[model samples]
Target chain A: MIKSNSTNSNIQQIKVAVDCIIFGFNDNKLELLLIKKKENPEKGKWSLIGGFVGFDEDLDEAANRILSDLSGLQDIYMEQIKTFGKVDRCSFDRIISSTYSAMILKSRYTEDKISKYNAQWFPITEVPDLIFDHNDMVDIAIKRMRRRVRNFPIAFNLLPPKFTLPQLQVLYEGILDEELDKRNFRRKVAQMKYLVRLDEKDMSESRRGAFLYRFDETLFENEQNFNL
Target chain B: MIKSNSTNSNIQQIKVAVDCIIFGFNDNKLELLLIKKKENPEKGKWSLIGGFVGFDEDLDEAANRILSDLSGLQDIYMEQIKTFGKVDRCSFDRIISSTYSAMILKSRYTEDKISKYNAQWFPITEVPDLIFDHNDMVDIAIKRMRRRVRNFPIAFNLLPPKFTLPQLQVLYEGILDEELDKRNFRRKVAQMKYLVRLDEKDMSESRRGAFLYRFDETLFENEQNFNL
Candidate 1:
């Protein structure tokens, strides 16, 4: 039998990679980011924006670095989803993958930026077949995202700074994948007491203007202990 | 770069193991179930009860099997705390370990069956050195147990079928590592409202027997949607 021994003086250490499954919303549509891998085994195929976790780096730092490398954004919300370590998960060697999920505002990319071979955004409804287990990775991330949103107000990270009640409702509906009664959603949000009216109205989207509101960050932090 | 491929082609996959750090309360102290390793890679050292996950099994099933293997019990409440994947975590090649935490009832362990091997209970205050990252695993498990008992009613799983009010209070105190006011603890538990009074009382320890109560599993399940 080929002994699985760590006593070998010549065996090399395994490389670990962190992948970020970032979701965004624009034009009332959910979107996901995919990057074209530059190097081999699985080159030219679209996959997650990911890289090797460096020495002495925490998992969150590695994930944030990958985000900055591709998206040019920093200090966005991120969470550790789960570690995926099935045999043959990676085609190269035994590369155990740790995945993190994040939400981004979707105005960061445009058509001019899309010409680059590095990364592109696809609507969540029309995403292309991803390379490797990335499709599975997105599925898992969405599950965690939905679970978190139900218990925590993390969807605010993906919304515009000044948004109307309808916009907030649309984000929740698209995320939860179910229709919510507008009156009930507003009632629930009011009960949570994290959103404050900003004395401004968004008049572009509809004939009757809707009042804009801002998420109370300090209040959210204070009341977060009561949340998940 | 090393080729990221499975070690062998067309062979059975490597087995996955889940070891549990089962802690209990007795004599106003926190205790851990430690077993002596029967085989090499640190044979004859005190460690936690562990076994391999079957192809059709989930991570929790593997942990339940380990509990049965050591204490001859099933349906024990357990939580998956963390997965350990340091390249050299195990002496053997690539045994990615997932550690689970369980709060076992002290009355559940069989003395004649438990004392057969080098298996014994060690108070959290006085634990022996363990093999590999098992000590790190225990540290994380205890941390989660303490956090969970403060916010959740998981301590009920570790108590006897019919326990007194003071016994329940002591379990929480042992887990939280703090002296709780007996009146305040009673008020908090009564507000949660899942416990039912039983007609029996324990007379062995005191002249004035204490009334016993057990948790209503159906009520707990019904209120699972809303936090206790």
Candidate 2:
């Protein structure tokens, strides 16, 4: 959408805001970071972490600022989902929001930090009714995330640095919201040479301990594996 | 992005605008509609058809209004490409514009109507340096269009109601910017049951004439063929 010219006498100046649907994965389920509104209008209701874009700020910078302030994390993998411009989206005013979907490591957000801001990670499937159009933002983000994981290794952003293949598969299954064949899933990962096996194992899941793996950044950057 | 609260005395309101990259396919090549800027900061230079969003207007409504005002056509296939929010993207002010890419049938734009608005079509590969961040917008839109054409039958929006297999292939090659094996291309298209072969033929390309085909909306809506 275009900006109204300063000379236009009748044009209205609408408020611009940014909302982020932060996704996390833990315990074989996808999680969403939601906070109880602390201000009036929709105060005390679940809502996506958001803030207004400063006059001199870039939309991305605003998104990052709000994200870091809320979750105490930096350099997370985020993508612009789409802009939501419904007139009545914000009951208090005419606010146009540029929404984004960010994948963050669930462990990065400490319990104390979350509690301080009244933020909590709810399972994607059981998220409470969010304020205004925040729920629609989450729904679109998950759908986009599901498609994104199949083509790119972006979902790895949600996994721990060292994770077993089963853990990896569980994350994929959770995002896809479907049961993937174990053999097929393994074969798919094996074909992606960017995944390097590590010496350590994750013993929490099995006594024998499934071997741990980490994404090889250098190889992933160089590989022509888009069809994966 | 978030809405700046009324109490934020230090916050500044930024300018917002919408720009559209109108796309068409004809003469075995992809085309983009561009207009000569009528007002400063860069008057007379080629620029995408754009306008500012009114205070209370929805973004989609603003997009449609600008498109129809310029092309005298409605119901165009348009999607939000991305929002360009760099501080220096616009020379005059901090205009954060949401860019959209639209697909239009070549026949829909008449020469007289185009000339009235000083709008003209340029080959996608030959588009001149556009105003502000429009070049970047077109570049990104083309990349996205390539991927979109592969998964969805959206490129058909650029074609007429009836088209030959060769014509369809030409449009695909134009968008993909690659030559496909005739046998392979035809085979892939034949497998899509949503394409209904018409008894009529298109004689423009060849004297013998090639049979025409039209997309079956009902079948296409029901089919699960995403690979085509």
Q: Give every prediction's interface RMSD.
A: 9.0, 5.4
Please give the DockQ score of every candidate, comma-separated.
0.14, 0.28
lDDT of 2 by residue, A1-228 (tens): 334354642334677788988887666677898888888978889999898887778899889999888766567757898988877787767778898887766666566777777688898879999988998888888877776677568877677788888888878777787887888788778867899999888788778989999998878767532310
TM-score versus the correct structure, for each prediction: 0.60, 0.81
In terms of DockQ, the best-performing candidate is 2
The worst-scoring run of ten residues by lDDT in candidate 1 chain B lies at: B6-15
Instruction: Report the CA-based lDDT of candidate 1 relative to the real structure.
Output: 0.71
Candidate 2: regions farther than 4 A off? A1-11, A157-168, A181-228, B1-11, B159-165, B182-228
Each candidate: fraction of true contacts kept? Answer: 0.09, 0.32
DockQ for the candidate 2 complex? 0.28
The runs of at least 3 residues in candidate 1 whose Cα sits more than 4 Å from the true structure, single-residue gaps closed, are: A1-7, A11-15, A38-40, A54-59, A65-77, A108-115, A160-164, A193-228, B1-100, B111-228
Q: What digit string (tens of lDDT, one per residue) describes model 1 on residues A57-119? A: 555677888877875656766776766655456655655466777776667645455444477
For residues B43-130, could you state the per-residue lDDT of candidate 2 as single tens digits? 8899988888876678988888887787665777679889888877887677788888877667766668777776888988899998
